[model samples]
Target chain A: MKTLVWVEHDNSAMADATLAAVTAAGKLGEVHLLVAGSGCRAVAEQAAQIAGVGKVHLADNAAYANALAENVAPLVVDLMSHHDAFVAPATSHGKNITPRVAALLDVMQISDILSVEGEKTFTRPTYAGNAIATVESTDAKLVITVRGTAFDKAETTGGSATIEDVSGAGDAGLSSFVGAEIAKNERPELTSAKIIVSGGRALKDSETFQQVIMPLADKLGAGVGASRAAVDAGYVPNDYQVGQTGKIVAPEVYIAIGISGAIQHLAGMKDSKTIIAINKDEDAPIFQVADIGLVGDLFKIVPELTEKL
Target chain B: MKALVPVKRVIDYNVKPRVKADGTGVDLANVKMSMNPFDEIAVEEAIRLKESGAVTEIIAISVGPAKAQETLRTALAMGADSAILVETDDEVEPLAVAKILKAAAAEVQPGLIILGKQAIDDDSNQTGQMLAALMNLPQGTFASKVVVEGDSVTVTREVDGGLETVKLSLPAIVTTDLRLNEPRYASLPNIMKAKKKPLDVKTPADYGVDITPRIKTLKVAEPPVRQAGIKVADVDELVAKLKNMGVA
Candidate 1:
């Protein structure tokens, strides 16, 4: 079987998620990386060096600058005839593009796949991570979005693969990029961070959330996350959400302050190396998975902890 | 301009589904069912658009078993002008649902089509984009905020890093995000009024669509259970443990 993995990049380098997807793609068969963007030759070169890749397909065009699914879906479709499996990291870009490719192929998309039982069979979580379902595809071609945390990142450099430039993947003049408001990250990105400090609904308001959460994150030099409840309560931006519907992170040390640990929230961060949970309720479900569970008021404990750190 | 909103019936968000003894699937029998939370947001957004006069009508549609009519009724009570049911018991994949919805959109000539980012049951997260692809229309997915003007719509989408605003021409599709809006509860009067609202039932056959499953469920199982870890008495103990791990 042959596989094509979408290499998500910022024109300069690839996202770690893409490397993780490569690890997954390598599990199936011969892996080919597709680099789609303007001025992506640099990204293409880096992708070509990935250990498992057999070849790199560069769909270089100005239309792909934003990695807009509208434009890149057609590019993936154009190459669909050549590969038996198509894979991408389950990032915002992957979630946006892979479904369109699957739909255009008239196949059911196997999304957020956790494990590859076979070339056509895979495991994924449903019911907001409460249960796992193993599904098999009979479709002639497979399109999958892989959960990056479930797989290790493939080696960045090894055997050199040949790069080919393929064009004429027509512009999809449907939607245009207006703008984006990205987090001004002074610390590392939450998903890739070594340490993460997260708050939950009990943080109350945005002011309190920042006042209580940010100082600890600064002291620990950690990325901050919020449970979906906190994001919904307007205590944090939607990007800060860490739950079934939000960014999944697997950090070395995860500290949860005032979090009740809904199953959905656990789906995102339970894979961390070590977890410390602090909440007033001794029975908070977060303690079930925490290495250290402290039953205390976060208002009292967090400030004291921050001063000590 | 008419707004087309596709709703779905699913296990309620609050319910913890139980995997069957044989691990075939989650047992749906006697489970509490409700309109998918994301679809509720979609319906609420369409109603808001109608109230703002940006949309002249709001049409709610669902493709499922007869019980799905109850879901549509809820949408009607929430302020949809009418409803359509593509009644089917066959498990229709998201591709087929998108095709069925595309046919409905063709008949309605809706200027805007709204749907949930993903149904809670299948979690495919495909219908809106698939419908957009099939119709050859623009799509703004995971939309937290939507604004409309003549022949143009702008959607603020919730992405991984932050918010991204995209501009799409009218006759497009927008998928609702959790932050779109807090859905309104149906009032007593509206619930009564909804029963009288126009509801048309059809089938996938009427739309010339085939409800086929391309994927097969090989097995169903529970996610790996994490063992309950030890609880420390205080911060000093916690820090001491972290220090031993050398990751602090």
Candidate 2:
């Protein structure tokens, strides 16, 4: 199987999620990294160094400045004829673009695949990760979004693959980027972090969330996260949400501070190696999955825990 | 301008799905079914558009079994003027649903189409994008904010890093994210009025779409259970435990 792994990247560098996609694609067959962006030659050069990748396809275009699905879907469509498999990290960008490409190919896409059993068979979670379904696609082209956390990233500094320049950079005139308001933080990104400290609705307010959670996260050098309730309550930005709807992370350690575990939130972090919970309610569902559960006020427990560390 | 919204009836977001004893599929025998949470957000956004006088009419469309009519009625109660039920007992794949919705869009020629980013049942986040592809329309997926102007709509989408704003031409597709808007509950009067609103039921064949599954469900089963551990007396004990396990 010839697999084209969509290498998600900024103009200057490749994203860590792409390395996981590369590993998943490597399981299929020859892997090629597709770096589509404006002046992404540096990113392409980095992608070519991944161990399993055999080649790098560059679709340098201004239209793909933000990886807008409208502009990138056609580029993916143009390259579809050359591969039997199309795999991408199940990130926001991949989720946005891969479906359009699958639709253009007239195939049902296998999304958030947890494991690849065969060329067409895959295991995926549905119903907010409550049930696992094994599905086999009959489509000629297997278009899939691999769960990034489930696979180890392919070796970063290894082989050297040739970068090929591909054309078809026409804008659909359908959509345009209107800028972004991203959070400015020094902590490791939640999805890529080795450890995570998450707040819930119990954080009371945004000030408390920062006062109680950020210090602990900083002390541990971990990413900060929040449950959907906290985000909905405006205690944190939507991007900080760690749930089935937000980011799924399987870090080395996941500390649930004040978050009562909903199945939605559990879907994201239940796969972590070690889980700790600090909540006032002893009956919180978070305790059911915690390796170390502390029944106390997070405001007091978190600060004390931070000071101890 | 007319806005079209698609709703899916799935196991209530609150109810955990129970894999059937034989594992053919989820056991919906007596479980509670509700409109997908994301679709509720979509309906709310469309209703807001109507309330703002940006759209003259609203249509709720659902592709599922006869029970899905109830889902459409809920949408109508939420403020949609009318409803369309694309009847099918088949396990319709996203591609097929996209085709059916494509046909509806062609006949209605709506200025905007809104749908949930994904369905909870299958967790397939492909229908809206697929429909956009089939209809050759622009798509703003996982949208948190939508501002419709004369010929274009600016939508703020929920990306991984942050919110990303995209301005798409009118007659585009917009998929709802969780933060789009809080969905309003149907009042008694609106529920009664929804019964009076027009609802047309038609099979997938009416749209010349074969609601066939392109993917085979080999098996469905329970996920691995997490082992619950002992509760620590306090934070000190918790940290001690983490250190002992070399996880701190």
Candidate 3:
């Protein structure tokens, strides 16, 4: 059986997680890397260097520039007929398109897989990683979305594979990218950062948020985060929210500032190696899970801590 | 134009779920079951789209055991015009649920389908896109805003680093994100009226879609518990401990 792994890239550069997806696909069968996007020659060339890959297929087109599922779905469906399984990184786009491909093939999909036990069985988290469930899919064709953090990226051998410019299979139709409003921050991304500084509703407002969270993140060279309560209160953007419904982060060091931890919030960050909680309320839920707890007013304590650092 | 919403019944978000003492699975014997919080957002968005005059009707659906009708009823009380129950006694995997929904959509033929980004129980945010793929339609996921105009729907989604907006033609699927909108509580009068709203229940077999799960679950285990730590008096002491632990 041959596994078709989708390589996700920025059109100019490949996503680091795609390497992890390629490594996970190696466990099932012989792997073929599929690079789909305009100006993806370098990505296909990079995929060919992964140690276990058998071949590389490039479907570069102008229609793929925006990468709406409308265009990518048909291409995957077209390619899937020749393979026994399909795999993609469990990133936002991968989560969006992989299942669609599975539905197109009339087979079941196993998503957010953390481990592959055998050729047909896998383990994944349930209830926001609170519990683990092992599942086996018996269909002849399998589709899975691999958790990038769970697998190591395969080493690159620096080889170039055969590149093909497959024609666009479907119309781009009406979709177009209008504009984007990205949060500009000097800190690293929350997912990959070694340290994270998160605030909660106790921050009061966005203007006041910079006082404690910013300097502390600067001290630790960490990413900034917010509880859903803080985000809902307009203290930060939705992307900054860390909770069951928001992003899952497993940083090395995590600091909670003025956040009364909710279970949903803890579910996302409890995996951090070291946790520090700063709050006035001694009974705050965050202290229960934190490795270090400081009971005091953050307004008074944070400035001193930032200065001391 | 019409809208279709799919809801799932999951462990109530407020409850701290516990594994069975026997290590069989989560203890559901007396646990509270409610509509997945994200699905509530989806239902709320569909109703808002209808109230904005873009959609003519709204249909809510759930595919699970008979008890899932309560989840659909919650949708009706919140403002869905009708409901359909795809009754099944077996555990429905994400793919099977998507297939059954595809069958349901083939019957309803709505202009748009809305679902929560993921069901909290399984956290598999795949069904919406799967249904879209099965129906050969466009999809906009993790959408905070969905605007329907003419034959196209513009959806604003929460992507990494920031927000990205995509426009899809009619008959598309949109999965709701957390900031989409705060769902309203069902009023007593609305609840009373919802009791009279039509809810059609049918088995998955009726639609020729198999509800059997292809995946078998071997075990369910809780994450290792985190040990409680000490409370520090001041920043100096905390940093001292951190330095000693090689974390500073």
Candidate 4:
């Protein structure tokens, strides 16, 4: 049986998360990374470098760059018969297309999977991050979206696989990328980061936010995050917002400052290996789940802590 | 312009869902169901758009068992002009729901379709995009603000790294975020009025849409517990513990 891992990219360059998905797909069967995009030969070459990959199937085209399920779903559906299962990182684009492809194939799609065992069973989180559940996908064709943060990224070696071009689907014009303004980030992607520093509304304003949160994250080489309240207040961007409605992140060490720990916010980060909460309120809900709770005002604590680090 | 908003019935957000004793799924037996909080925001945005006169009609759609009608009525009571219930007892995956909505969108032919970015119960954040994909329409996901100008609409979207704006012509799909808008409570008079509004009942078959579980759930188990570490005072102790754990 062959397992296909979807590779995302700018068509010429492979995304780090896509490589991680290929590394994860290796556990199930001979991994074949599906590089879909316009001029995707580079993506195919990079995917081939991952140790466990057996082949690189390149579906190169302009339509792949502005991937809408309309164009991508049919292609995956057409190729489904050749692969026993499919996996992709649980990013926004992957989440949008994978389920539709699964539905088109009339099979189950297990999403946000964290671990895999054998060909049928996988483990994933539930109730936000409150509980973990093991699931078995007995279907002949299993479709899934793996949480990119859960696995190690694949490293490059000096070998290339045969690049095969595939064609079957065309854009149905469901949606088009009019334009995209990528957020500039100097640090690693939040989901892929090993360290993360987050702040809540208690930071007061953007200036204070920059003073306290940004430097902490920078010192720790961590991604910066904000609570929904902080984001809504315009202290940070929506992408920086971490909660049930925002990004789900799990890092090696998560440091939360001034967050009162709403269940919604906790749902996003409770999976971290270690949680450290800094809040003035001893009764703050975040302390209940934090591996280390510092009972002090973040205003004073953050500045002092930053100096030490 | 007419607008359509899709709603999902889910376990009340305030009521924490629990895995069942048998481990089949979250225990929903006798659980209080409500309009997903995010969907409520979508309804609020749709109604606000209609009230602003940019829209002339507001129709709400929900795909689930008959009980989902209650959620639809809530939208109606909050000022939706009409409601459509696509009844299905099985777990209708997000993609199938999007397909069903695509057919419903064809039938309604609304100028705009709004949905919550994600359903808290399943956290599948796919319907709005899938509906757009299935219908071959433009979409803006995780929209924090939506503005309509002439024949085009601009949506401010929240992405992983920051905020971005996307523009599309009319007949676009917009998914709501938590901060989109605060929903209003239905007044008693409006609740009574909702009973008189038209609520069309239908099924996936009516729209020629199939409700299939694309992803099989093999098992549902609890997430691993995090072992508690000792509390540390001062930076030295904190560093010592982190170093001991090899995490610093």
DockQ for all candidate structures vs. native: 0.75, 0.84, 0.69, 0.43
Can you give the TM-score per candidate against the true fold? 0.97, 0.99, 0.94, 0.90
Q: Could you tell me the lDDT of residue A23 within candidate 3?
A: 82
| Model 1 Cα lDDT, one tens digit per residue, B142-222 | 999999988999999998879999899888999999999999999999999999999999999999998888889988887
DockQ-based ranking: 2, 1, 3, 4
Interface RMSD of 1: 1.4
**Top lDDT prediction, candidate number:** 2
Residue-level error in angstroms, candidate 2, position A266: 0.6
Which digits, one per residue and each the tens of the lDDT, describe model 3 over residues A139-233?
87988998765787777775545565566575657466666677787788887677899999999999999776898788877899999999999
Query: Which candidate number would show the highest DockQ if scored against the true structure?
Result: 2
Candidate with the larger DockQ of 3 and 4 = 3
Evaluated at residue A139, the lDDT of candidate 2 is 90
* B1-248 per-residue lDDT for model 3 (tens digits): 88999999889998887866665567877889999999999999988888899988999999888999899999999999999998887788877888788888888999999999899888888888888877778889999888898999999998877898888888888999988899999999999999999999998788887767777787888877887688999988877776776654
Predictions in order: lDDT: 0.90, 0.91, 0.85, 0.80
Candidate 3 wrong stretches, greater than 4 Å: A46-54, A156-174, B245-248
TM value for model 1: 0.97
Q: Note the B-chain TM-score for every model.
A: 0.98, 0.98, 0.97, 0.93
CA shift at B178, candidate 2, in angstroms?
0.7
Query: How much is the lDDT of residue A85 in candidate 2?
Result: 86
Best-performing candidate as measured by TM-score? 2
What range of 10 consecutive residues in model 3 chain B has the weakest lDDT sum? B239-248
